[model samples]
Target chain A: MDGTPGGLSGISAPGRVAAPDEGVTEQELALAARNHGLPLEALRYDVTPPGLHYVLTHYDIPATDADGWRLTVGGRVRRTLDLDLDALRARPATTRRVTLECAGNGRARLTPRPVSQPWLVEAVGTAEWTGVPLAALLAEAGIADDAVEAVFTGADHGVERGVEQDYRRSLPLSTAADPARDVLVAYEMNGAPLPPQHGSPLRLVVPGWYGMAHVKWLRDITLTATPYTGFQQSVAYRLRQSAEDVGEPVTLIAPRALMVPPGFPDFMSRTRVVRPGPVPLAGRAWSGHGPVTRVEVSENDGATWTEAELVPDPAHPWAWTAWRTTWTATPGLRRLTVRATDAAGNAQPLVAEETWNRGGFASNLVQRVEVLCTTEATAA
Target chain B: MDGTPGGLSGISAPGRVAAPDEGVTEQELALAARNHGLPLEALRYDVTPPGLHYVLTHYDIPATDADGWRLTVGGRVRRTLDLDLDALRARPATTRRVTLECAGNGRARLTPRPVSQPWLVEAVGTAEWTGVPLAALLAEAGIADDAVEAVFTGADHGVERGVEQDYRRSLPLSTAADPARDVLVAYEMNGAPLPPQHGSPLRLVVPGWYGMAHVKWLRDITLTATPYTGFQQSVAYRLRQSAEDVGEPVTLIAPRALMVPPGFPDFMSRTRVVRPGPVPLAGRAWSGHGPVTRVEVSENDGATWTEAELVPDPAHPWAWTAWRTTWTATPGLRRLTVRATDAAGNAQPLVAEETWNRGGFASNLVQRVEVLCTTEATAA
Candidate 1:
């Protein structure tokens, strides 16, 4: 994705600022930020801190004792093989920075929110994932030609649809074997061994796909000629567009962008009074479809659009790209809207209603930031 | 809904029990219980503790300075009156015990879980609410004959569906004025002034209705000739049965029951293993339609249902009724299911899939409790 840089440098100001909202006080913002596993304030840089990454788990973090941990490759393989943690680690390592997002990230913002995790737009983050290439391990196992899909299963298990089973998903055998896809059997995150909450000993890191495909606390890989009809695979993440439609299996993440919640830099302000003159807005944008090529900002409720300057960070191409824009301050309640376009031509929708799915999957709607600016007289 | 008391006395041995589930360990259960604002161990009491009541708020809780707070009655009313907290308390006071449940409760159990609050069955509790009857307040203001609905507005405000407005809902004037409905302008919860999280100073308590109808932090009562089409009223809580159906507004709580998550009294047990033979199970049952009259328990996945003994607690008509049953144990994995029938003849559904709503509202399916028991030799 390519974009012409605007004059405004989108970097956040030094120190921390509370999220912008008329209802939220500084104290509440701090608690909310802490609750989200991120600073309430937008970061000075675009790439999120590894520790601050958002976490969502259907089950508790598996207490994986690495000493006894093992990975089994079987099913349609020419030769079954089992490897321990050390064995997998010794076979050549690679690290890639990638953005991972929950499929239900923005589900709460949909016109009709479903009855599941009330995730806002914060259920996404980027991190450097280190592991051996999944393709390399698959090659060692020697997949049979008739294999159709590769099933990856995690240690986390729960009951769904009257069936009790571990969390599992299957990718087409061709996609699993594609070297360019950068599929990984990750054991490290951000240069550190994987934390328990993120998947302790081993996990799958599938770039470009939603987090569901990256099964955490991974333990087994089975290849089969038939498509796997497991709960999470065929039933859970289906993107049913309408009542009559059964929905297709959800895959790649959609293009999306988010601005730091607008707020005054100073905590002492009793009112949301923005200083008169040019106001700089900073945030991050990303796309699993492809790199974000352009991000448009709208101050008049999408009545008009202006391009924001994109901050190039080639080191983490799969991570979110930082962007900033300046707006002339006017004394009134202001609502800022943002939409991003990706290289794959997917654009964030103006409204989520059009993209409604039964399971509330892939809800990438235009983000809105509301701010109130008071004149000096009103502020006084 | 009435049935003859069964011989099995469902009284639970005193104290709390962990929820029976193969997947959740004791540690995870504690964390979950803490997150839900409930006691770490599920109790046998039919009435829920006020402090342990579950809470879910769309906007931050309003910091209410009670002295300055005022409730306004206007719109289609003949006279507009501004009443302070003292003025409300000065009027006739009434008390009622009501069970309020979030519409999104039991959402996580849906096979294709929606994206909202990951509420299990814990999103329900009964509390004794003391307040001034709303009908009396509306009478003082002189409701106009042309008024179609009485719209209630809370002080809390936020941006939802791209609009900045106070959280609001409108009830049909007939429903608001019906004395039998027992709608209240509540100021006290369980004999104490309302807690901030439960809506300080004033809130609405609509007995026999979903929690959404009980608007918290209430500030205004506006009578209107037309129905209120606010974000929460028309969109957020609408129970869309399918993509094709626009769905009706969700209201009354459904008939349902839940036993303490079956667990041992001692925390040392790593696995949920119970001694073989007669096992007693106890829980509470409720319904917004009317008092629960019958509760059925099944350990064989609905193959054979047995009646549970109901403890009569009719003093609090709106409160849940305590029930219990004993099941003969076998040395194997056991899935226990419970269902309740309300006085109005509404029964908890056998399958939530049939009653699936796009927003996942009013999901009151039978709860299944899974546990495993081993022979003495295997256990040793």
Candidate 2:
């Protein structure tokens, strides 16, 4: 409760360039304010800071002026090119530093919720990516051994419940043509360019997948042999229990990302309401998807679960994993829950199984929150 | 339910490594009874594949006939040094790759409702560490800013529940006096020499804690201001729930780890869950005392929770995160739980309140499991 949002040491900010959470420079970021926020000075990275960069691109705006931009390869292909950005700048381009989040960021927090883009819980970012290989242009546009999916169109507009929506997702054509594991097409980021709300000349980086399959302004690249639906596919990402249990979405990007599970927010005892004494149930867990093998804890709400001690961050296994569980605060009224499992056991879901569809994609489940504990009768 | 040994599988010669349902990696492996595999042998720049490289150390063995050895540093310091091995190889050394795991490599699956380490889970590996700075021998043993905690005693030996435990862990005197996060004593590893189960003529690497503060076979270093009570701090990393609600006992070494959520285990979902379709609930979330913000999921156990997609792979803050959720099989019986949260929100507890504790250190709670939902009339 102290990131000092108001623990105020004077509480009077007003300007860090225009602190609406910064970011507003690609020459003041306009397309009539692409969606607002544009003035932290075009951002380049100081650990992201610039109130965290911006770029959302998903609806037209593809006038691509990087020498007229091209990037289009053609279905399954035996050969059918388009290339531009000066033929992908004559091939070869590497740079990796990756990290990008935003598949509807937090999706209006969800709980049977819908209609989103409102994004918060930060929206998630981290860049460095530079491109070229779409599998060396799908081996000079010739890869078709029966293509097991690669679909992936994007220009972004929105409208899934009413139709229209133009952002797709599908992968696993061996991670859509690996190409030394870059998958790029990118137009540079973290070093500059590619701004028009992130997808200026071309996009689609696809490294570990899910940034909505790195679509953003990129246009067309079929390959298919199966799986790659519309409306972000079955209304974006997916995870609606009861269809006899789920798990067949997530076209390409792997690397599960999201955390905090381990006596979290435990002011004392699994948030035994919040206070009674020691409480530190804090949390955070991650693994680009293969390292976090375990992190479990719950306070009565989910009956019982305990197993926190998953430390791993040498140089970061794709990054993130921190934990702790200390409770002593047991007062009353608490509803805390935390779950995470990976090394491939998979867990996290308690509710939110409404596939109402609209534009909201893949809303995980099992995130209970309720806090307030007490233990201060000391001045006796 | 297919890990063999009663979990089925039987014998095999099928594909390679016996392949059979992803089972079969167990040839005893708790403390390696020998018998293991992976040798197609291929590497150019190496993305890990020396049988997955990263075995790490805190002493499992470090014997090769040692060319020489000494490396002492003396406690409460003013200058109680030792330095042999060629004056500690004439000062100055560095070779980084950093990655170590094994706080009991999965603690023998953490409870099928069991309690002693039979450890079949692999424990983890990854090498390339090189060492030198124990604050450069605690600044050649000059440390004494009233040191608050730096106890790392190890020569590795164990017996636990029946007593006999050596391997210690204790940090915090500002991480035993940081010098830009170094903390080593290592005597070469990937470049060779430093392998007696690993802790050769001295060890204590401490890159972000855990792996039990890298004790290994390295003699001692004690400077203490207090921390570390024993039994790995009272019974192997505890974290129970109920029974009065523990608050803190953990001998000294917190900052848990592990978060490899959904990325690796996909040979394309291996037959895509045998066709009954829909099943995307993945895991991995982390934070030892910081970063992983949110990764919620629960399908009716904690009643409700939905918030998964927290992709951060770099500025760990603490480290570990990779969460996913998309279940959809639907047939019957299935229970799971995961927990993690931090960036302050904290979380991770499904029950087992504070885990009473008589010995177990920090052992978190909330990781329920149960599955069985075949469908299609139990297939066809």
Instruction: List lDDT for all candidates, in order.
Output: 0.69, 0.47
Best by DockQ: 1
Per-residue lDDT of candidate 1, residues B1-380 (tens digit): 00112100111011111232222221222122212422213245355544446666654455577989999999999899899999989999999988778887776566555544445566777788999998988888899988999999997654343334578998998889888788999999888788766888899999888888899999999999999887778767887755556679898888988776453311111123355788888888889888898999998889999999999776888877888888788766677899999889999888878667667788998877656543422110
Q: Is the docking of candidate 1 incorrect, acceptable, medium or high quality?
A: incorrect
TM-score per candidate, in order? 0.50, 0.34
- For model 2, how does the per-residue alpha-carbon lDDT over A273-301 read when each residue is reduced to its tens digit? 23456666644544344556777767676
Question: Over 4 Å off in model 1, which ranges?
Answer: A1-46, A242-244, A265-273, A375-380, B1-380
Predicted model with the maximum TM-score: 1
lDDT of 2 by residue, B145-262 (tens): 6667677766544222223245666666676678766677787766766644456656776653446567766766777555656655543444434234443433322222232221
After aligning candidate 2 to the native by TM-score, how far in Å is the CA of B72 from where it should be? 17
- Looking at model 2 chain A, which ten-residue stretch has the lowest summed lDDT? A7-16
Query: What TM-score quantifies how close candidate 2 is to the native fold?
Result: 0.34
Model 2, docking class: incorrect
Best by lDDT: 1
